[model samples]
Target: MNSEVILTCAVTGAGDTVGKNPNVPVTPKQIADDCIAAAKAGASVAHIHVRDPATGGVSHDPAHFREVMDRVRDSGVDIVMNITAGGGGDWIPDPADPTRGGPGTDIQTPAERHHPVGELLPELCTLDCGSLNFGDMVYVNPADWLREHARLVQAAGVKPELECFDLGHVWFARQLQQEGLIDADPLYQLCLGIPWGAEADTETMLAMRNKLPASAQWAAFGIGRQQMPMVAQSVLLGGHARVGLEDNLYLRKGVLASNAQLVEHAASLIENLGARVMTPARTRDHLELRGAQTGGEA
Candidate 1:
C-alpha cells in the first residue's frame, strides 16, 4: 500500500446537482469558500468548475472563474487549484432532428474550452483524454480536439491532469505523452462509475491502472455511493484519491455532506488504512508541479 497519498477535492462540478443537494456551491463566493475549507480539511488539491449563480447551470464564463480564483488566492490558502478544461463538450441530440443539437447541447471549439485555463494559469487543468457517452448526452472530446487541448495546456506551463473515463482514454493519454504534448511527469485521473463509462469496481480500476506508464502519477474517483469505496480501493492499489461534492453529494445514505466533510472523511479513511494524506506543498513536490499563478501568463 502507498504510505503517502494526495487527496484532491472537486469542490464544484458541471453537473445538475445543485438542486439535488443544498450544500453544492452555486455562486463563485460559495465555491471559493468551500475550496478553502477543503484545503483546511486536508485536501491537497481543489478541482473547480464554475456555474451560473442565478440558474445553477454550468458556465464557461471567465469572469466567474476569475472571481473564484481571486477569492481563493486572496484567502491565504495553499490549495493547488485544478480548473476543468473539459467543458463545452455536451451534445444532446434533438429528438425530432438528430442532425441538430438539442436545447441543452453545448458544444465548443477547443479554443473555447481552453479559454478559462489559458487565462487563469492555475497550477493544474484537466485534459479529458477521450469522449464517451456521458449519461444522457455525448461528451465529445475528439482525438484532434484532445491534441489541441493538450498543446494549449502545455503552452500555458500548467500540468494537465489527463482524465481517463475508460480504458481507451488511458491509452490515448499515453499516446499524448508519446507525442510530447504533455511535458511534465504525466498525471492521470481515472474517472470511474459514470454512466456509460467504466464501472466503479476493483477489476475495472485495476485494468485501467495497469495501462498507465511506469513513470505516470494517477488518482481515481467514483461517483455517488461508490465514492468512498473507490477511495480505499485506489489507495490500496497504490494510487491517490479524490472526494468531494462533485462526485458524491452524501456522506451517508441520507446525509448530505459539505465539501469539507467529504475531504475530512476521506482523510480519515486514508489514515485508517495506514497511509497519510499529502499537503499542498508536498503534493506539488511529489507531482513536480509548478507553483500556482494568479493571472494567465507563461
Candidate 2:
C-alpha cells in the first residue's frame, strides 16, 4: 500500500437505490446532510450525484445541485466536492425501432451533460471516457461528445477525472490526454463491476493500472460485493480509494449502511494497512486543486 492514500466518499448516486436501501438520501437536504456526515467521518472528497425529490430518480437540475452545495458549505465541513458529469448518458434503444431511443433514455448533448460542472465549477468533476452497455440501457458517450465535454471542462478551470469503465475507455482517455484536452497529471477513476465493464478483480485492475500513464493520479472502485475487495486492491496498487452507499448498501449481510459508515470502514482499512488517509485539505494540496470558497480545511 502507498504511504499516502486519499479516501473519497461518494454521496448518494443517481441510481434506483432509494427503494433498495432506506438509508439512501433522496432530497437535496438529505443528500447534503449525507455528504457532510461523510466528510466529518473522514472522507477527503465527496463524489456527489443528485436525484429528483419527487421520483428519487436521476436529475440534472442545477438548482438541486445548488441546494446540496449550499448545505454542505453551510455545514462547515471541508470535503473536496467532486460532482458527476456521467449522468444523462443512459440510452435505451427502442425495441420497435432500433434506430430510436426508448423511454428512460435521458440522452443529452455534450454541452448539457457538462453544463452543471460549468455552472458549479467544482474543484473536480468526472468525464466518462466512453460508452458501455450497461445492462438494458447503453451508457453512450461517443468520442465527439467526449471531446466537446473535455474542452468545456478544461475551459471552466475544473479538473476532469477521466472515468474509464472499460479498457477501450482508457484508450479513449489517453487519446484525449495526447490531444492536450486534459490537464497535466490528470486524475482518473476506474469504475469496475458495472454490467459490461471491467471486472472488480485484482488482475483486471492491475492490467488497467499498468496501462496508465506514469503521471496519472488515479482511483478505482467496484460495486456491490466487489466494493470492499477493490478498496484493498486499489490501495495495494498505490492508488486512491472510494466508497459509499452509491456503490454498495450493506456493511455486512443483511446490514444496511450509511455513507459515513462506508467511508469510516475504508478509513479503518487504509489505516490498518499502514497507509495514511489524506484529509480533504491534504487531498486538495496533493491534487493541486484550488481551495474552496469557504476556505474550510480537511
Candidate 3:
C-alpha cells in the first residue's frame, strides 16, 4: 500500500452534468471557488475544465480559462493546477450523412486543443494517449495527434498526465515515452469505468497498474458509483487517487455533492486505509512538477 498519496479533484468536467447536479460549477467564479475549497479539503491538485456560463456547455475559450486561473491564483490557495487539453475531440456521426459530423460533434486540430495549455502554462495538463469509444461518442486522440500534443506540452514546460482509458492506451503511452515525446518521468491517470473503456473492477486496475513504466508515477479514478471504490483500490495497489464532481456527482446514493465534499470523503478514505494524502508542496516534489510553488499566470 502507498502511504504517501496525491489526491486530485477534477473540479468541473465537460459533460452534460450541470443540469443533472446543481453543485456542478458553471461560471468561472464558481469553478475557482470550488477548486480552492477542494484544496482546503486536502486535494493536492485541481483538474479544471471550463464551461459556457450562459448555456452550461463545454467550452475551449481561452477567456474562460484565463478568468478561472485569475480567480484561483488570486484566492491564494496553493494547489497544483491541471488543465484539460483533451477537449475538442468529440465526434458524433450524422445519421443522414455518416461521412459528416453530427450536431454534437466538436472536433479540433492539435493546435486548437493545445491553445489553452500553451497560452496559460499551467503546472500540469492532460494528454490523452489514445482514441476510444467514449459512451456513444468517439473520443478521438490518434497517435499522431498525441505526439503533437505531447510535444506542445513539453515545450510549454508543463507535465503531461497521460490519461489511459484502456490497456492499448497504456501500450501507446510507453511508445510515446520511447519516442521521447514525453519529457518528464511520465505521469499517468488510469481513467476507468467509462462506457466501453476499461472496467472499474479491482482486477482491471491491477492489470493496468502492472503495465506502467517502473519509474512512472500514476493515479486512478472511476466514474459514477465506482468512484470511491476505485479510490480505495488505487491506494491499495500503490497508486494515487482522484475524486470530484467530474467523475461522480453524488456523495452517496440520492445525495448530490459538491467538489469539496468529494475530496473530503476521498481524504477520509485514504487516511482510514492507513495512507495519507499529500499536500500541494509534497505533491509537487513527488511529481517533480517544476516551479509549482510559483503559481500559474493570471
Q: Score every model by TM-score.
A: 0.97, 0.97, 0.97
Give the TM-score comparing model 3 with the true structure, all chains together. Answer: 0.97
Runs off by more than 4 Å, candidate 3: 292-298
Find the 10 residues in a row with the least total lDDT in model 2: 289-298
For each of the candidates, the C-alpha root-mean-square deviation to the true structure, in angstroms, is 3.4, 2.0, 2.7
Give the distance in Å from residue 159's predicted Cα in candidate 2 to where it truly belongs: 0.4
Q: Can you rank all candidates by TM-score, best first?
A: 3, 1, 2
Ordered from best to worst lDDT, the candidate numbers read 1, 3, 2
Q: Write the per-residue lDDT of candidate 1 for residues 119-165, one digit (tens) a residue.
A: 98998999998999999999999999899888888999999999999
Q: What is the C-alpha lDDT of each candidate?
A: 0.93, 0.89, 0.93
Q: Tell me the lDDT of model 1 at 121.
A: 93
lDDT of 2 by residue, 76-121 (tens): 8878898889889988888899889988889889899888889988
Give residue 265's error in model 2 in angstroms. Answer: 0.8
